[model samples]
Target: MGDVVEMTSELGFKYSILASGSTGNSFYLETPEKKILVDAGLSGKKITSLLAEIDRDPSDLDAILVTHEHKDHIHGVGVLARKYGMDIYANEKTWQIMDSKNMLGKVDNSQKHIFSRGKLLTFGDIDIESFGVSHDAINPQFYRFMKDGKSFVMLTDTGYVSDRMAGLIENADGYLIESNHDIEILRAGSYPWSTKQRILSDQGHLCNEDGADAMIRTIGNKTKKIYLGHLSKENNIKELAYMTMENQLARADFGVGTDFKIFVTSPDTATPLTDI
Candidate 1:
């Protein structure tokens, strides 16, 4: 990812990816009032440093929103929330599994927030709408948030996106989506047969081709930015992921920078602040 951020003169919601990929995943979203983190798959120290880069303090966040109980998504959720005494939000099933596994040990009961899948929840001025995603987890969901007349969709970790889910998120101004792997590379790679089979299954992750195809199908007039995340380190590279999607869109008669900006988030570094 680069430092070029799509910015406007007016004050609005700002977003940045702290880290994204198989090792860990986390991102920051801020309105003028609320500071929210999508996931804390990384360590507490790493997340804090990333926040420091953006001149934000860990204590400033209003809430930490978890997508699922996978370690890559919630590894640091406990430590961060405990350190800041912050509110943590997840669906009841996710919370139960995490608690049962002792993944997030001893969180404040009052600070634990829950929401129902396929329902809308409000946090101050932000409206959070979650829909079930076909991931191999205990009722995983993809989040759609609306605030100040603008909307964003966070869709990732799912094996495939259903048409109904596509329609639900088509109107988003910003979409943070997964471009996990390359089909050919994955099939020919050195991983074991069973692991590869599971990955290629519907309950696994999305491949680059499928993700791009879905994006093109669901893209709307309101769409402004497309973030490509959750890349595979061994099976895929950044250039391959970017070009595969870019070329597909180009073939569909959509200019890259002109139609909508595409930001390729890295697994290690934080992208520049982008205002939406």
Candidate 2:
């Protein structure tokens, strides 16, 4: 996940995981005519460096879309939007929380934009659709982007993906879903009981098993690429998460490399530019 590459010339759709995990999370997406970041959880400097590794400049980004108001997701949103003069889009509830808590410091009024849930947001050539998720934050949501008859879905920071959500994201060309933790490991870990309970709750993060089930419910013939994102640093191991998903999918007769490829995103590095 460390190698950097130049943007592809033939790209109708491409994306890279700038970083993932509890420490920080961000995604970089490119269309033929637009560049956008899904989240900016790291410092502005760190995010800029990650972009530079992939031959991207922060200023080149057209928009910054927020999934929630959590610090890990909005840490760099304000800084990047202010420095680059980029639009910041989020649902009204999320925007209200951020503004009330001053989570994003002083973004210009013009740069602030609101989007409705379950509605389509057109950003350049990409048609973006957002859906609510079971998260602790007020009105947390995930997104699916469609372009050129292909779709790419990015889902994380959710406790579970409901049947309705599965239907909405089904049959996409690519998916980046959360595989946050291992249940056994989390129970055995040193986290306080309350914290553990919160994580295991319906409004907390998804465990490996649940994440696998969510994927199994969705994913149609059009699906080819999958990314395991937002893994826990202490409660889960990378290899364990990968094996859990692989074995679970295998039970359903879906071969990993044959049905689709899975890539694990890193908390500190950028994955290679991947085409959707």
Candidate 3:
């Protein structure tokens, strides 16, 4: 924890995992000149409160970026945008699905912005880019934010990380990736066989082992922080997810507290603000 604080204090950008899991998912990122919310999965009031927990205000956010149209990813998007009058950016396919389902309510034309998949866009002092991820949603994607020489990747809900996907986000200073379930637990748990199959499918969520492998393939000399997010309350234990990552990275010659630090995100609370 002390190491985390020391490293964060030395950096120019900070971020926190507001909430992460099946119930809801949101992330808050702050640069010297910009405040960004990657997703608002909780209610508008809840997100505002989460922001306040970290001494931020909803109205001060420069933009709200959407990765996909899943309810757990966009539940509060419309309300946040409407209430704060902030710009919301998403891919055209995501916007189409959200609009078709009325998922974001009534966002004004001025508040809706679209960016092409895999293209880079600048927001304030940050450079943001989105890339395709394998997930069961209309054009599901994730983002990598770069400012100065540091980069942070917000990646979740993807079932598999192809070499290409890993390459795009490689060498990021920090990452927030899903370590959703333990295969053994999911296979033995009582989530209906079909649901289990879906989660185990190619378009489903990444299990703990896969998530760890993704991190191993992406970690570089500059990587210092890793956030294991989107755990399954029924299928995964926080400690188990953390250990899985720690153990796997260890085999690859990475030390948990020395090479980099690991943070396990929660569905009900905010993680410590970290910078990299």
Question: What are the Cα lDDT values of the candidates?
Answer: 0.87, 0.91, 0.90
User: lDDT for model 3, on a 0 to 1 scale?
Assistant: 0.90
TM-score of every candidate: 0.94, 0.95, 0.94
Look at candidate 1 and give me any clashing residue pairs.
none
Q: Best by TM-score, which number? A: 2
Cα lDDT of candidate 2 equals: 0.91
Per-residue alpha-carbon lDDT of candidate 2 for residues 1-276, written as tens digits (9 for 90 to 100): 987987655545889999999999999999888999999999999999999889999989999999998888889999998899999999999999999989999999999899878889988888999998988999988899998788899888888888989999999999899999999999999999999999999899999999999989998888898899999999999999999989999898886889798888899999988777
lDDT, residue 173, model 1: 86
Across residues 206-276, which tens digit of lDDT does each residue of candidate 1 receive?
Answer: 89988898888788777889989899997787889989888888888776788698888887788888777
272 in model 3: Cα distance from truth in Å?
Answer: 2.1
